[model samples]
Target: MTQVAELPASAAEARDHVHALMATCPRPCGEDALTDALLIISELVTNAERHGGGMTGFRARVTEDHFDVTVEDASPAHPTLPGERPAGSVGGYGWHLVRRLATSVAVTPTARGKSIHVGLRLR
Candidate 1:
């Protein structure tokens, strides 16, 4: 699958887009992989919305073995994984979780803002 579009800053809207993409994805994805993908997508979108000052663009690509997701936001501040939080911390988990789940992740800073790219291997 290959598609790109602008997404609202809202997590709910981002989730809706993820679900629709999954439904029509070119290859059948295992439930577990899809769930993981959803979680990663949610966190990325949420981070873009909450920390990046709102999402400006979203793109997703799925292949037989992996999926790639990219999110662009309006803030130039690059995202960073917070230092180890105390156990049971209430927040600061999004970037960490993305790093844990994705096979590879990258953040690119642009003149206008930044973009996050995550690649997850299918189960």
Candidate 2:
């Protein structure tokens, strides 16, 4: 079974929402995982605001095997996997970091917007 929650637009609010969701997950997800999740969420939200034409909403779902985080925004621009994080780059490392931390990552473009989902395995 999976529990789902919606996050607000504010970064602080989103962070708190994700923390609370992680706390309630069935499996024991570590602090490091939680921190990484939060960072990924922050990056996604920031991208939504800057590139996706503003975030519509975000969903956090905890499944029996994994924890899934999905961010929805107003634009149809699908997120891509970067080859590498260039040195001296101030930004553009969010998706890269998310892919590194999560067991799997996906991006789906819908009629409304695009959903960037990251899955963290529950061991």
Identify the candidate with maximal lDDT: 1
lDDT of 1 by residue, 79-98 (tens): 66567656665678788888
Model 1: per-residue Cα lDDT at residue 90: 67
Q: Tell me the alpha-carbon RMSD of every candidate.
A: 2.5, 2.8
* Candidate 2 residue pairs in backbone clash: none
TM-score of candidate 2 on Cα atoms, chains taken together: 0.81
lDDT tens per residue, model 2, 46-91: 8888879888878887765577888889999775445554566556
lDDT of each: 0.80, 0.77
The 10 consecutive residues of candidate 2 with the worst lDDT sum are: 80-89
Q: What does the lDDT come to for candidate 1? A: 0.80
The estimated TM-scores of all candidates read 0.84, 0.81
